[model samples]
Target chain A: MNAAPGVVAVALVTLATLLIGTWGLRFSRTTSDFFVASRTVRPTLNASAIGGEYLSAASFLGVAGLVLAFGADMLWYPVGWTAGYLALLVLVAAPLRRSGAYTLPDFAEARLGSRGVRAVCSLMVVAVGWLYLLPQFQGAGITLRSTTGAPTWVGPVIVGAVVLANVTSGGMRSITFVQAFQYWLKLTALLVPAVVLLSVWAGDGQPHPVGGDGWSMPLAAGGGQGLYLTYSLIVATFLGTMGLPHVVVRFYTNPDGRAARRTTLVVLALLGLFYLLPPVYGALGRVYAPELAASGRSDALVLELPRIMVDGLAGEVLTGLVTAGAFAAFLSTSSGLSIAVAGVLGQDLIGRVPAGRRLGGVAAFRLGAVLAVIVPCTVALAAPNLGVARAVGLAFAMAASTFCPLLVLGIWWRRLTGPGAVAGMLAGGVCCSVAIGWTLLTPDPSGWADTLMAQPAAWTVPLALVAMIGVSLLTPARVPGGAGRFLARLHAPETLDLDRG
Target chain B: MNTPDPGNPRERVRVTGPPRRRTPSAVRPPIDTETRLGGMYLRSLLREQLRLAAGVLLALAVLVGSLPLVFHLAPGLSSAQVLGLPLPWLLLGVLVYPLLLGLGWVFVRRAERNERDFADLVRGADR
Candidate 1:
């Protein structure tokens, strides 16, 4: 593939993102605007922004790659990711927005009335944010290397710089416009090429995917272990969406609890529509580009497919379009995450410090943005290539184990005490982190151990829930006196004239 | 016991007026103060919402969650064809997206209804 088009596509996406961010910055004058867009974003716009930010490199490129490489079971990744929002809608959406939290840590503080829990939550947010970010950075590296012949480091550096620029310039308000633009850009980039490619396939002859029974079946031949892995993945993704700091923060941008629920519903539809295209690319890749899987470069299957199937300017254009989408995926997701992490860091870590207190809210946030991007970019450049989808899966597992329990229990369980929240978070966070570290640092081929370590959500989530409930029961006296009032606020409709204090 | 303390000169004027009714203002809904009735209202809302959420998740579990086990138990399903593609391919890939969207829509509609009903009940009581 000629590098010129790919280079131009990347440049265009970067320029568009920066321009949109700057445009949004003009309206972002207050601290509230920087954090939650002054709680004025409508459902459709917020949903689009959420979709843009939520569909990271994992969804954009990794899903196609995994589908190309693995058989039918890999389809669960996309399904689980989309279904996550369903879980979010049914459970966490309205109450979380009503909590009036600027970030996950803020939610913890509001619910538990404990600075200790808030501090712990802030740490978890940064950890999950960075874990999720590593893959986006890594995916960017892979994308740039394939498209523009750049070194792996170049991609992360450029993406990190772009994210920092966008986040610092406009904060949440600016990134909302930038990310909403990205959703449509990404959709067009994938959809147009997919339609054209499908027609091309039909024109030639719609050949069936060449695979054995396992490729077509959900879990053919692989027995108990495969079932465990699949279930673990489902648990992680279904429960974890609510826990993702960037995703949850988007809800706070909605005008109220009702809009938040509406936004989530729209997100589900948007994600469902977007997810349909990746599998098409994946299935087509299986038929047209099997060598990609064999060569261990299936992650590039989406970018490489158009060029391989067609041989002309049109093919180059399709490649350019997909590349632009992939780049936009990285930019939008990274900007959202950086804003989320920076909000926490600015308020909890920096603002609490003597020198940091002297800096204004925006300045502290700008510094936090720089700190947030640099660490992940550096780590991504240093870390060996973990498959993009798998790394993201680990992050989901971490979130499911940690924040899922906190959010669910804290919102619904009035008896939940601060001690219980702290204990649950620590237990879940520690166990998941250990499991992730073991899985990443040491590759164990042992059967059950490997599976359990690789997909820890099944056990970790239960442990977290049990710890929270049990601890809360034991420490009944420690439950906050304002629990009833908080529950009233969380459960009541915004239309009701409640004090909510 | 009836005599007021001389050190505290403020009048204890509780003589003859009928006890004032504690009518909470509309601006400050009773739920905020967790009155017995208000607490009941909040709990009822929470219960209804939780049930709705549970119902959605159960449907998800039964419909989507059991597929892997079903396929694993009966491997022959893999060979079945639909639209010239294998059954698993169609079920997992193309069809599941719409199913998910439908599930989400159903949940949202029902949940919002529950909230609206709760709001109406509360407002009716306030009136």
Candidate 2:
């Protein structure tokens, strides 16, 4: 494949992202602005930003690839992802905003009033952020390799540098604009090609895609295991969205609880629209390039489909467009994740350092950003290529297990003591991490072990919730005295003139 | 002036009727009930929100959770063609997104309405 179009596209995307970030940098000065865009972002823009960051390489490339490989069951990936926001909107969004916390750790410390709980939450946030970032780096590598025949490492290095630059400079304010722009770019990149491809298919008499017997089935061949995997996937995705570190932090940008809720509603619509196009690629790929699926390069289906279906300049241009979108996806998501991780590290780790009290807020955050990106980029280089969607799913499982319990219980139950929160998080984190580690190391496992390890959310989430409730009940005296006031603040509308303080 | 002792006793008697009642204009009435921070009031609001969320979750659960069972029991349904695509293909790929959006729309509307109702109740109680 010629490298000019792809290189130009990638470079253009990088330039645009940096330019936007620098432009937004003017508005980012104060600590609040650095952390949550000064909590002044309106709903539509925030929703766009959320959609942009949320639809990562997993959504842009992974969904189509998974669908091409696994057929109908893979639909669960997108469904679970989009529906996760629904869960967020209903259960977490308003209350979390009302809680007046900037990050998950902030919420934890405020709710449980324990240094230990905050510490655990900080650690988990880092873990999940790294886990999520690993795939993005890997996906960038894959995209670059396929498009330009560059060494695999180049992609991760370039993406890491760009993300670091954007995040360290402007923080959340810059990322919000960059990500919002990316959402539209991604949608257009996919939508225009989908429309053209459909027309081409119609012109060519619309050949039917060939799918074998089990392709359309919801479950895999192993009857019981398949059921387990499906349910586990449901459990993970449905509960996990609220816990994602980057996603939860975005809600804090909303002006108030109502705007936060509104942002979520718009996000659902935006995601729903974007999701429609990927399945189109998947379905069409089944007809046009089934061999890619067999050869295990189905993840490139979205990138390669336009060229396969169209001819000459049009195909090349379309390919360039998609390459740009994919690059944007990597940059946007990596920046968001980096900002989230850096914020945590800055506040809890670097900022806490008593090194002559020299490091200021921006300096601490910049240092944290470097640490956040470097570890994941290095890991991506060392680790074997886990499919992007699968890796992200594991991250979700981890989040669902840990933060989901923390958020749900912290908001609703006044009896959630600090010790209980710590216990629950540890239990969930350990269980999910073990399963993820086992899967990553083993590569291929069979029988019940495969099903259990691959999708740990079903068991792990319940374990976390149970541990939290049980431990809280056992140590009722440990419940924070301010729990009642906190609950009232979280649940009441902003219109209510309550003494939240 | 004519009866200083009698006048002093009468003034003390007039001031003794609960200071709050004596100067109702000077003191604003306590709005604790309107604040909705009382345990019962807070509980009811939480319950209302939880109920709305649960109802939305139930709808989503029933719609999505049943797909595997349906596909398993009636394998033919998966293969059946709809809109020139397999039933599963059309449903999962195309239709599910709209359904999710609709459900989300309904949930947001109801949730906001619940909040609105709670706010109104608090304001009414204040009056």
TM-scores for candidates 1 onward, in order: 0.95, 0.93
- Tell me the TM-score that candidate 2 gets on chain A alone: 0.98
Q: What share of the true interface contacts does candidate 2 keep?
A: 0.54
- Find the candidate with the highest lDDT and give its number: 1
DockQ of each: 0.48, 0.29
lDDT of 2 by residue, A405-478 (tens): 99999988889999899999999999998998888778668989877998999999999999999999999999
- Here the TM-score of candidate 1's chain B is 0.77
- Candidate 2, which segments miss by more than 4 Å at Cα? B1-37
Question: Model 1: per-residue lDDT, tens digit, B1-127?
Answer: 4357788869594566554344446455567776998899999999999998999899999999998888878888877988987888788777887888888889878888988999899878777
Q: Write the per-residue lDDT of candidate 2 for residues B9-126, one digit (tens) a residue.
A: 6543233444431323332222333343466677888898999888988998888778877877777787788877778878877788888888878877887888788778766655
Lowest summed lDDT window (length 10), candidate 1 chain B: B17-26
TM-score of 2: 0.93
Per-residue accuracy of model 1 over A1-501 as CA lDDT, tens digit each: 489879999999999999999999999999999999999999999999999999999999999999888878888998999999998888899999998878999988988899999999999999999999999999999999998888889899999999998898889999999999999999999999999999999998888787766676778755999999999999999899899999999999999888988898899889988988988988899889999999999999989999998889999999999999999999999998999999999888887787623777888898999999999999999999899999999999989999999999988889999899889889988999888888877765568987788899999999999998999999999899899899888878887866655
Candidate 2 docks at the CAPRI level of acceptable
Rate residue A294 of model 1 by lDDT: 95
